[model samples]
Target chain A: MDILKEISENLELGDFEKVSLLTKKAIEEKIPVEKILKFGLIGGMDIVGEKYKTHQIFLPDVLMSARAMHAGMDVLKPFFIREGMPNSGKVILGTIQGDLHDIGKNLVGIMLKGAGFEVIDLGTDVSPEKFIETAKKEAAYIIGMSALLTTTMPMMRKVVELLKKEGLEDKVKTIIGGAPVSKDFAQSIGADAYGYDSTDAVESVRKLFNQA
Target chain B: MRPVLRFLEDELIERIVSEARDVLCKLGVEIHNKDVLSMLGEHGAKVNMDKYHVLFTNEIIDKALKTVPKSFKLYDVLGNQTHDFSGYDVYYTPGSAALNILDYDTNKIRRPETSDYIKFTKVVSGLKNIASQSTALIPADIHEKISDSYRLYLSLLFCEKPVVTGAFTIEAFEIMKELQIAVRGTEKELAQKPLTIFSCCPTSPVKWSDVTSQNLLDCSRFSIPVEFIAMPLSGFMAPVTLVGTLIQHTAETLSGVVISQLTNPGAPVLYGGSPAIFDLRFETTPMGAVETEMIDCAYNEIGKYLGMPTQAYISLSDSKQVDAQAGLESSMGATLAALSGINNIAGPGMLDFESCQSTEKLVLDNEICGMTLRMLKGIVPREDFPTLPRLEELLKEKHLLISEHTRKYLKEEFYFPSSVIDRANRTRWEKEGRVTLIKRAHAEVEKLTRDYAPSRLPEDIKKELTKLMMGEARRYDMKRLPEIEI
Candidate 1:
């Protein structure tokens, strides 16, 4: 039996310690790094993502499997970086400036991670300048912002303007969400898209990549 | 003609009561207040002072149960006896201490001020089915330390009906008593008339805090009727099963009864509860959930079995707004509690998980309470069992709309809805601008508040009441209290 097949089995089963040890064992066994990343870890996570979409698994189950996939990825990441980073695009997520609410943004981050996107969480009370700098430094393709207070919703527009000012508007798409964020507000702010909830945010991010 | 609603069989009642007694004797209850421990010890309870747990034997519990008066009258502002809270009779009031009011016109949720209390009381006074008053809104503008006293003061001034209100601190409790004394003339007369039923709650998981325990003692000493509300959140503070939760409720309520009796024999107390199932998903005690209604009905059954006057927090909705969910949950709870023969049904006009109040909901629940009362009245047997004469009359008429018997029985037998409920014909309804229940209720509320004229207090007593309240305010360095135009 292939060791990567066993790694996929353990990853799907959500056994993080076994996934980590098996990935190390596969590396020692002279398995190709791309096959381990694609056929083993990503393959397991793809099944989890489908299960999550179809309601076969819930948030807690998806979270556990994502954790297992991360265990395997930790062992294989150095090899992938040397091989020029064979992975999905990056997404920078945060609550907008002067807003201390990050629960929605954190949920979107987890779902994005489960769907194989590398997410950089900037946390709450995040300024627009910090979001643009991180997107440029990480070469991220998407910037997602959340604000639970209507008072702080205007900060999302500032981030979009900063992206345009830095000449990264064409390269990066912007998405906004939260209790107060609406489609009309998104349009008025000139955002690329608006998500009603975290699940909708995942679908919108996937659509953005599909268009690219 | 009112049909009694009973849920428990004799055998099951006996079983639950016996189990509760066994729990009290064996498991005991934790009382953090040393004075309560001493009081229970003096009354023959096996109190372990170091452990702060007192074990009540069957003899002690029976003695305490006997001391509580089975019936009492709650008085209105004019010193007239209002609802007789005894046996199967039930009264309705809005839930208290809501932090915000839903501005119906603006469709905005904001903190309620002293002005909102005036409006709330006026609406409560106008509604016929809302039998009592509660300081429903805890104004955000008042000083936090004196807010409870200020709420009672406002209730005494604006409300014509007796209030279902309480105190937070010992000073607030004394001040509330002073306010009641001002209305009743003397402390003895106030105790005899009982303008308010002070509510004291014991913290869940079988622990009594110092403040609530002291309140029990004060209520006993003052001879004021007290409502012992034991709220247990199932699966968290209490057992997850309904039967287990009931056992805990029985034990906690019985413990409070024992304390009240020991403080002063024949201290009037009402057995009441607002137990709810803990929602593990949201980590909230959803009071409007169906399981909560079931808990209420089941506990009231135990209360009636003990021959105790019972109160249940019902008719409260968990909806954040006055939407369909609010109507459904509120009506369901009101119906269930009333049908279960709860004596004092206290939860109406409350929304957003009991943290907010709305005037529209108050008027809406007035209709619900009327319907519930009618349902509790059941089918009447005015004549003999045969009904041959009525049958013949019905057959002869074919249409009983204008029959003499139909006209005679119309007001007595049926529940008549007021303007808040829409029952007009389609053509008339359309011609009337298709008025919604909310719109009618808003109009009713506006008219009620605008037309309200409070019972005038004597100048000297009014000044005395103001001076007493100001004395407390001065202690807190509050320069200005909310002015009252009434």
Candidate 2:
């Protein structure tokens, strides 16, 4: 079977070992990195997402396949990046000030990059000024803010205040989120958008882009 | 009539509060972590020159406790809000699952981005059973520095019900404000009342870190009803006995309430504790242990008795995952919580002894919550006492009421889950295809995600968001790359 086909199939099956083996073979054959990334890896993930969309796959299966994809990517990581530049997208991500929990935010970051968004992760405990400054410096269009603490949930709103006060809110479309954050809060805070799950965020962005 | 537990006495409330203050004030809760000592000193608590502990008298606590609000309001999607959380009208606070997607490209695990939330919201917005929505796990923005921001935005679009969520940094808070405006169309309307968020201070009986203090200040200033979750690992970070543990929990929780209210008086606060004991055997805190349940029950009683709305971390277990242990522990935990009449139940789908979160477990726990609520409904009368002639005629020499027209409503009158639990007989089940509980749950989860189409977002807003994201990519010197063909 074609190596790409094998790799994609293994990823579909959530077989990490097979993915690794196929990855090695594909690498030995000197398969193009871009092709494997798109046709093999990304393709497999898309299928997994769709499968998840339906009843064809579940969390454990997705986790297992993603793990397998990780193994295969490890072997080819050095080569892919060394051979060429790492894939990148423009993103500005950070946890709101006074808040430090990031499991949800971090997960969003991973999915963003996987979906081909260039990510700029500002570590947690970030402030409003810091976000504005970074967004300005990077000229980032989408500024992502996350808060996991109820105490800090308001800080996500403060970032919006800073942006508005600085006249940066319009220039940068700010998106806010966390366990306690809601669309109502997002709108009241004057943010561009809010998301519930990581994947839904990705699709929302894509939809936004298409509409734009 | 409900069985009243003696733990709910008002005298006990007064005693416990006083005792907790005395212990902290006199003994000055030990400076277990040096860093915490510095933070407390910085935060206005007077530290003895020696810095072994910080002395705060009963007066200070009394004064601080005065700032805590009894309740706050959360506006609904229709603009209606509720100050009380004990409506007993089940509200949705985001699904209890930690969903992750691996970036095969990056070979790293990450939370999904905006698109993830958009889909979820479409479903959530449509869910009548859900009282509120969550910022789930997606962030709304795309940050080349970290990850995506879908979870953040979807909280705006999904359920439209009040959201249960938090922020990681101040800037994120700003975006959250903007998103609220986007959803509701006016920041002024959004700010008319307090927005509640559950911010976690570092596990207490341990120490309050600097950031944790900052988080408190942040929420207090914004008037976000804050639920300070005080998690103390017993026998490790806390005391070995239940009484000692309660004292420790009281100190920690009271301290947070004081700080938050002081920062902003009348700011709503809810007292909560997820206090559990370490098994010593597994070297892990068994969330399923009866002791854990007892501690929660005791703490909840004390808090509510104090005239504060309470939050309890219940419906959780010590199991590693969703299995028999998970079922047993969750059933007991949820039962204790519902019967105890806890205002809020956290860690519903938490598994692996709270080490991890699971989607499967969340869906299953939702079912459990339903069942538990039903159980709390107490027994109902079958009306078979007299064996009336009419009913006997309907039964007519048969032990079954199969021919009774009223029987048709029996299924509707009773609630049944389609997955994760089985009710079919051996032969029917086998014939229908012997599906395992987990497998059935998996199927259910898939169906939910697939069919879930929450509320919709305005077209203009979506377009604006996308334009910004792509522009951000270009600004970061990123390539548009190629299209992902389905």
Candidate 3:
């Protein structure tokens, strides 16, 4: 079997150790760093994402494959930095203030990482000011907010307003997603995009950067 | 011969209990309240102050279990015993704390106001099969700060049944306790015959929030009966496996038991939970899912093993409307919960993952509850031992419909549902306007609301309740409460 094909298959199977070992062996065998990342790591995640979007696999399966892809990425990261290859983009993610639900937020973070975007997760109950400060400090390209409670959803509007007040709305796009959030709510709150679920969150982020 | 259902065998029950104790000792539970942490530290448990985690020894768990009353009685506002949560008897109540209500008129899910809650209370009071009334809907008209106490106040006024309620904030408990005390005339009298059971839920994955922790402690301090709502969403907040979820449920519930017992020994509590299976497709917790129902029954077995009265949020549906799915899911849940012999069975009239409640569905579920309760009586020889005599009477009369034995056991042997259940022949059904279940339920709701007489509370107590509620309502900048015809 081709070594890259073996790596992609292992990553798809969520065999992190095997994927990492194969990526290391491929690196030792003089495979280009970009080829290892694209054909080996991203190649496996693309299939996982497609399967997830098609409902052929569930969230847990997608999350496992993401972990395996990260294992492969760990081996290719130093090489990518040495070669100055850019990542997908940096996105700041968190559950809005007064809400302790982070599962949806964490799933979005995992999918963003699986899609090759850099995710700075601030965890749950994150205030609006913290989101703005993090985006400014990280120079992030997007701010994604999640909320599971209708009560805490209004806090998402605060984050959007803060982005405008800080004059970062043009620079850092804001996207919101959760069970209680809707496209109408996002538009009402002046948000740039609304993600219906984790899969749509990635697509929305891609669209925000005109990469879709 | 009463029919019963057991989801776990003796050995599995032991294993689950032992594992839950092990989890408490090893993993411990994170409590957000510092006072609780210090209290646990004082009680000889290993308390991690920095993390607010308390690791309990088996000795502490055993001590708490011994103090928990195996059974307790719930009383109505008139001081009449409404429920005896002992033996294998099961009682049904509507599920609580829904954000929205399915409007019977509009056929839409909308936020409930004070009037909606009053109508709910009035309807619940007339429900013969459902034994207790819950503070089911959160009224959106009131200030969120007073919403918790407002529901309790309304329930007390409009209904005489024992209330199943909980507080959202620590301050709300004071007013709620005051309301109960006013009804019972004193703190000691209220505790003696508890008029309410506060639901103190522990956050899944073995954690307790500050507000919920305080509510648990307050209920314990007053010796008010509490049901520890250990809501472990399977495969999401908790483990993927059923047994894994049970262990988390046990651990979380035991942690609550320890807190309540340590605070005030002999605190009345019911081992209860609202566990649901996570639907991966929609990312929703479907309470009506079979796995969720199994989790509810399985935990009831565990609760029984611990010698505590059990409560479960079963007999509910995830359907958006009162349709076939609602009927199927709710009847399945009610039947299973009844067979399991859960002491306090909640989730009647609940829909959309317990986020919405429907009065039409409540009327429908009352029939379901009546049927399930009759099933619990089981088949027994009721004067049928002398089969020859009844056979002769049937043969002589060519029908036994008016016979002595048939007439005697008519009400006992059969569950006669209300008009909500369509049991008539096709001709009669069509003659009765060809009404749907939702339509019949709408008629029933209106009839029940119209027929409900005023509650029998004394005039002085009624005035006291109004005074107390108005005082709290004014604190939230409200001058007047909603108008109720009753």
In candidate 3, position B167 carries an lDDT of: 95
lDDT of 2 by residue, B1-486 (tens): 343333446676667678788767776654434444554565566676454467665665676666566545677655667435642322324333344522323534456555544544544454333445555554324453212223444454344566666555433454555555555566546556544454556456635554555566666666666676777777887888777788788888887776665566677776776778877887987778888887887887777665566666667765654679888888787777666666666665566555444455666777777776556555555554675864667455332322343354444345555456786444335645898776676566666768765445566765554444345356556555122111
For candidate 3, what is the DockQ? 0.00
lDDT winner between candidates 1 and 3: 3
Q: Give DockQ for candidates 1 onward, in order.
A: 0.00, 0.01, 0.00
Q: Alpha-carbon error at B92 in model 3, in Å?
A: 0.4
Give the alpha carbon lDDT tens digit for every residue of B117-204 in model 1: 8889888988888999987989888888889888888888777789888788876888889988988899899888888888889888
Candidate 1, pairs of clashing residues: none
* Model 1 alpha-carbon drift over 4 Å, by segment: A1-212, B381-407, B456-460
Estimate candidate 3's alpha-carbon lDDT, on a 0 to 1 scale. Answer: 0.90
Candidate 2 DockQ category?
A: incorrect
Give TM-scores of chain A for all candidates: 0.86, 0.70, 0.92
Candidate 2, residue A102: Cα displacement in angstroms equals 61
Off by over 4 Å in 2: A1-212, B1-13, B27-54, B64-67, B78-83, B87-130, B135-150, B185-188, B191-196, B318-320, B380-413, B456-486
lDDT of 1 at B435: 91
Task: Name the 10 consecutive residues with the lowest summed lDDT in model 2 chain B.
Answer: B397-406
Give the TM-score of each candidate. 0.67, 0.57, 0.69
